[model samples]
Target chain A: MILQKISKQGKGELAFAGSLFLLGIFVAWDTSKMVIPQGSSIVSPQTFPYMVAAFTSLVGLVLISDVLRGRLGTPDGAEPGDPFIAPSYKTMAILMAAIGLHVILLEIAGYVVSATICFFGVSFAFGSRKYLKDFAVSLIFALTVYFSFTKGLNINLPAGFFEGVFGK
Target chain B: MGNSFSMLMDGFQTAFTPTNLMFGLLGTFLGTLVGVLPGIGPALAIGLLLPICLTVNPTSALIMFAAIYYGAMYGGSTTSILLNTPGESGSVITALEGNKMAKAGRAGAALATAAIGSFVAGTIATLLLAFGAPALADLALTIQPAGYLALIILAFATVGTLLGESRIRGLVALAVGLVIGLVGADLQSGALRLTFGNLNAIDGIETVTVIVAIFALGEALYLASRHTLVNVEVLTMSGKAWMTREDFKRSWKPWLRGTAIGFPLGVIPAGGSEVPTFLSYGVEKAISKNKDEFGKGAIEGVAGPEAANNANAAGVLVPMLALGLPTSATAAVVLVAFQSFNIQPGPMLFQTNPEIVWGLIASLFIGNTLLLVLNLPLIRFWVLLLKIPSHYLYAGITTFALLGAYALNNSTFDLQVALVVGFIGYLFRRFGVPITPLIIGVILGPLAELYFKRALQISQGDWHILIAGPFPKIIYSILLLVIIGPMVWNFKKKFANKK
Candidate 1:
């Protein structure tokens, strides 16, 4: 009870439920905008979406009531997670930035460089301080995957800096 | 159906080929490799390997997939016993007694019983699958579209209400998946429903990408945020890694009992894997003479649930092969594997693709024997995999997940989609929503909708068709009872309290 009060998870859940409600409304709005071609259609494309919207909104309301009854969502650890420990937003932010960089620079910097950076950044986020080892492993992994795909699978990956070195 | 024996013999003929046998071996090893990783389950394991399934022979590949499915079961138990940590949800109960046994210096007995129990249950259940699937497929063919509509409704309802701690949250998660699944064009009309006017969105989100991104990539993101890495003291096995005579006496009954419980639960859509596993554990606990030794490492506790987990896995394939229903997350991924090869697994599957169906069934038996023989000898090699640091394991997963998602259509846009979906997955975990329902919903929703509309079309817009057939009538009646029975009980309990 004391942890619940300090965590304020009840309020956070209420907000989440409210957002689900809004999502329901958005789905309804999207459904209403659909232009159904004229026919003797028994169940149109919009039928399932409408049902889904109603269900979503109804469940959202039910969740809000559940929160009102002091029921809050329990944090889970599908992996080996310590739910009591506060999440490291700094680590998550770094992870996001790393992935974003990987996506954007994948074409320009190539699969090996971008993937290596992604892997390195992710390792750092997970509290790996050994930079040289992490980078070396990451680079080797990316290279093996890239070459395996290119040669064995016959899939072309962007060469970037190594353009014409690996092949056309 | 009487010729199922001959068909099985034919299946063995196909599965025994050197190439297929090699692939099955490779799959088992790869499966165990992924299974030992901290957060990777068979769903994510199978999803990562989808790219390879495209190029490989379907029969050989399916044989491999079936082996992977069984191999992960063996791998999960290994972790639970040695490290006091479950690699997957199904093995959570295994960690309870198995780990205690390990600490008591009986790690070998625990490992042996688990491996043997799994093999016993797996072989028996695969027999049930082999004989029962054809008969059930014949039965499934008789069921009308409305019956199918009722069945999926049952799937959605049970998956929504029966899973997780909160019914509201599960249903809400299912609703979200339905919405996401609806993003592609309508199945029959081909009218785009929620494309939001994007040119790329017309083809709908790729299931493989979503599965990989959410299960693998999303999991990595969630793990990255958790910050703390949990490492248990890995127990060293000694004193002969084989079960003693007394250990065998205690374990055999539970294995048989666990098979009975697991196979039936797995056959039905409502029987999510956790139930049978936990049910097996509870049943063993209730009936055991050594009940006092339960928490301290009773061999019955290890044997029953481990058997149930494997049998339930085999059982899940029944409905998936006979009727196109996937009850659990792993089943959903396997269903996707069949679909990836443009093979829709239904009553017609055996009629259409006998080799793939029978070959997969035969491979299950082969894999069970393969693991039973192999796991004991290779226990040390498998244990060494646990030495991989959590940070490096997760780092490698992140890279592979990104690559897997990127390879889907070779579009950077899909990379962004993967990120967004992975973020959603992270949020779902933070809120304690069971994700299996969400995956089941996304994969099964469209099919359910198609069945519903087809049922309606058959009746010329009459809604009563849903409850018309005997199957639908029976299904809906049972579902109604399942839903309403609790409310009535609560009402009476409240009245009694007032008195």
Candidate 2:
């Protein structure tokens, strides 16, 4: 049973290392495809990319060897007594989805609206049950930031829905 | 010396303007608030604010940003004392004795010592920065492209070694950052390398976007995902803010010693508050008169480490200001802030924009004084921040993170990039890959490439030119030693064990 758990951990690390190795290969392949224009600078752009690709591949190999040797990069418990607990996938997924939705809706729905929704979504993901309070807080917070950025700082945020109302 | 002194005076004139002072105050207050909050350090605070600050004047923006960095350093100890939860890694040592002191009803003394110690250390370190940076910049001005490339390589080595548990993981994280940095069109050839045919990819990813994603959004998501598991209980403050005379006597020496130890370590490439703090703790434990109180709430433990932590934070700025090299994660974000203002930090920074450079150094003094005032008399007010619910705080952080990314270029594409990078940041955190190297990589990768290519151009594309210079040779030798020193020691240890 112990052996199985150890191997599982090894496999997990191996998967990460393998992906990294593949990424290195992809970088090398992609860099090769880049065409250097004639009369460009003395050194081609490919040189640095090639070096990076080679370095990445070498490091990937090193990581694989290190993992296979049963060496894992363990957290050193800098904050003693506070053992690291991996975050749940459900919460991460929900939060990630919420952020993605915010990004997609940001220009379409506008900053204030998307931000409010994102805030509430995140609050909910973190197990906040007070819907009304969260909603009120999110709205006020988003609106305040919106005005501060646009009016005070003069950075034009996307006023998609509010453009007509704000006379933009 | 006279020139630097007068330059600092000019810096003070700029830093002390009413508007700049107000910004400094705001930054300090905000920095302290975030610093007192669990899991929200200066790096996240700066990342969240970087976009907003971009809209403000460069000098004022940097003044506020510098204030936030110092303020966070001060505020981290508040949580360490009051809740045993350190808001930053540097404050972990303080919590060891600080929380114990709180439990024993000496929380006020611990809190006062930490604040006062930080002020003293901060002031001393700022003085060192004021004096040291100019001299270092003068030296840096003479370094050629090859030497600069070597220095960058040295930075990679030191950051990789110091940041993570394993050098391999650190290097991997750095390489990942280098790849991310290389995604835009190559400046030399104007050839697109890794854009993948997206119009938004042509400009390359903004530093602000990467910073917000990794430090702010990534950290928030991680915290939110683990929200249910980590229960933070705040300890109520009970005593007066004033410390006893005996407490003062015990703390002063440690404060000075910590400053002495922390400043040099901070200036070195192995830049972090953690090492100096642990060293301070050990040194204090060794020399304390009340040795019996070492584990169970020694005041010296709080005083020394807190001082060391703050001094170390200040120390980190020296290399950053002088060399355009960020020694710590927070400094890396600040480096991006410099870029946002079109102010490149390095030897030329001092020569070109002495106002910004010296003004920032001068503002550290102002920020430190403001932090001392805010922390001491208003300790109760700051303690209330601990009572804020984790859900609301983290939710607010993520919302601002998204907004900040969007505000960078008013593009949803940047937000999407932030989200993607944030996810990568989350994975980096989960896997125990040190994120600092990745940040440093993203910030320094282009510069390293620029220098490397410049060196090659100068040498007519000969690789041996990289090591031809005495400076580059020395730097290469140091890199070799740093990489192989541990392996040799470990091998020797194994052989000795066999005997």
Candidate 3:
């Protein structure tokens, strides 16, 4: 009875494997377009990516077979536990949007401004209500970083509008 | 010995400079803060600072780096005791007994022993470094690749034996890491192997990104999902911070033994402090007059492991200075720092720059003293760190991680890579895979591959050359036992039982 109940539960791994297989095939095909003629003894740059694509597909295949054979199913005689559910699509969408927006803003605002804003904003997302503390900490972190790296250690960071204004 | 003493005196002169002392204090303070917080290890801190370390005078810069290392070691025990969370791998062992002590209302004693033991070990180990480094350096210079390879094999065996609940699982984790490491660029052919068409992946995944993603971020996500937050009660202390005479009587011997064991092992390649702590714990369990107190809150267990952890931390520096080999992930980042200074870490380093070498050694003694002063009297201050709301703490950690990633190259692309790796790390954690081995493989993978290929090339592809020299043969023999010996013993036992 328990085994039957377990078998009827979610198949997240199978679905995940299927999605990965498709992603691999698509990426591999797109990458093949960037390949150019290469000299002997030097494999085309596409070779590595293609190999990865192949490996991913192979792993996907094994995963699919395992799912089919019910090997991916929770073991028999195991005590009842919650079914493994996949991540919510809404959460995935939020993560993607945050990353996309961050990337778009990176070059325009430069590191100092962009990093400060992102750090504060991200903290707010994680349920931080203390804006004053957040702003103060983030700014201090950014400024200290600016001084430590720019003045003390001497590494050059990206310079935006405030570049010379900050004495960079 | 005379030259070493004189060299240390010169080092003391350099390290005592106002600027170096200030930097050491600053690094230790920051490192302790970061180490107290879960999901932030010294590696991430050093990586974030590597670009900046390039500009400073190497000696002062190194003083700060060493300070950060000592701070992290001390800071790691805080979270382990207070929240049952280990901020770094070394602290995991602490969590085993520390949390138990906390539950039993002996949090103060646990914290006190850990701090004092660390101080003792750090002091003794630093002194050892001062006296023994020159001789070790002279010895290391004569070591050929064969001997070095053997040392690496021994380290591998130790890690394999010590990690994971089951040896099978540990080996599986190690093998998985090795496979992932082999996925990237093939150095000999200049051919990328597993980038999967992403231009970003052409450089392969940075070890820092992989480690942070897998261990730190992944741990966060895992904990978040479970929502199994333990409401750890703060234990108020009863007496003065000083240890009782009985406590001293029990702790002194273990402290010395831990130092003795940890120092020698620290010089081995891949000989991280984690193994020595475990070994010390086992030895203490066997030898302690008060063995029943173990796991139930033994002060000796706390003292020995904590001492071993710190002593091993110092011991590992010998090779890091002499041969430029890093035994732990944190040391690997430091190796990168050395390279950023355009200084290769090997035997020639001492010849070319005695000031930087000896100065850094002297600074460690000073840093340890500083850590001891800061750690003990400030236990209450550290405990207050736990009072910060969990939501805010997590948010701050995530924000720092994101900013750190962005600060590296000022590319949002890297941030996205960190995120993806973080999510992937979450998945790996959800599965049964251990992440440390993966990081170990990634960091050491290229080096191992490079050496293996060079050794092979020098032999014109003769595979036997790997086993030609006595050193290599000895190393291989140990590696062979590490790889196959357990399985054989298991099989033999199973058959014997059947018969």
Q: Model 2: which residue pairs collide?
A: none
Q: How would you encode candidate 3's per-residue C-alpha lDDT over B1-499 as one tens digit per residue?
A: 9888888899999999899999888878877877776545566656554544445688888888888888887888777876766666566668778778777877777888888888899899988877776777787787665466556556555554444333433333444444455444556565655566667666666555555555545555554544443445545554545577787888889889989888887876433666677778878989978777888888887888889988988887877787666667677777766765678777778888899888888888888889888887877777787776664565456545665566555556677677776765655555433445555555555656556556655676666776786767767776766666556435422422231
Worst 10 residues of 2 chain B by lDDT: B490-499
Q: Could you report the DockQ of all the candidates, in the order they appear?
A: 0.54, 0.58, 0.19
How close to the true structure is residue B127 of candidate 1, measured as C-alpha lDDT? Answer: 98
For model 3, what is the alpha-carbon lDDT of residue B122? 89
lDDT of 3 by residue, A39-106 (tens): 52323345445644565566556655655665553211112254654444443343334444555665
TM-score (0 to 1) for chain A, all models? 0.84, 0.86, 0.66
> Pairing residues by index, what is the TM-score of model 2?
0.93
For each of the candidates, give the backbone clash count: 0, 0, 0
In model 3 chain B, the worst 10-residue window by lDDT is B490-499
Interface RMSD score of each model: 3.5, 2.9, 6.6
Off by over 4 Å in 2: A1-10, A75-87, B484-499
Please write out the lDDT profile of model 1 over residues B1-499, one tens digit for every residue: 5699989999999999999999888888877777766577777887877676566878988999998888877888898898866756688778888999999999999999999999999999999999998999999999999999888888888777766656778888888788778886776777777787877777777777777777777777777787766555678988767998999999999999999989998998754667777778888989999889988999999999999999999999999999999988889889988987889999999999998899999999998898888888888988888878877778788888888877767788778888888887877777777777788888888898889889999999999988995899999987887686435334322322231
Tell me which of candidates 2 and 3 scores higher on TM-score.
Answer: 2
CAPRI level of candidate 3: incorrect
Pick by TM-score: 1 or 3, better one: 1
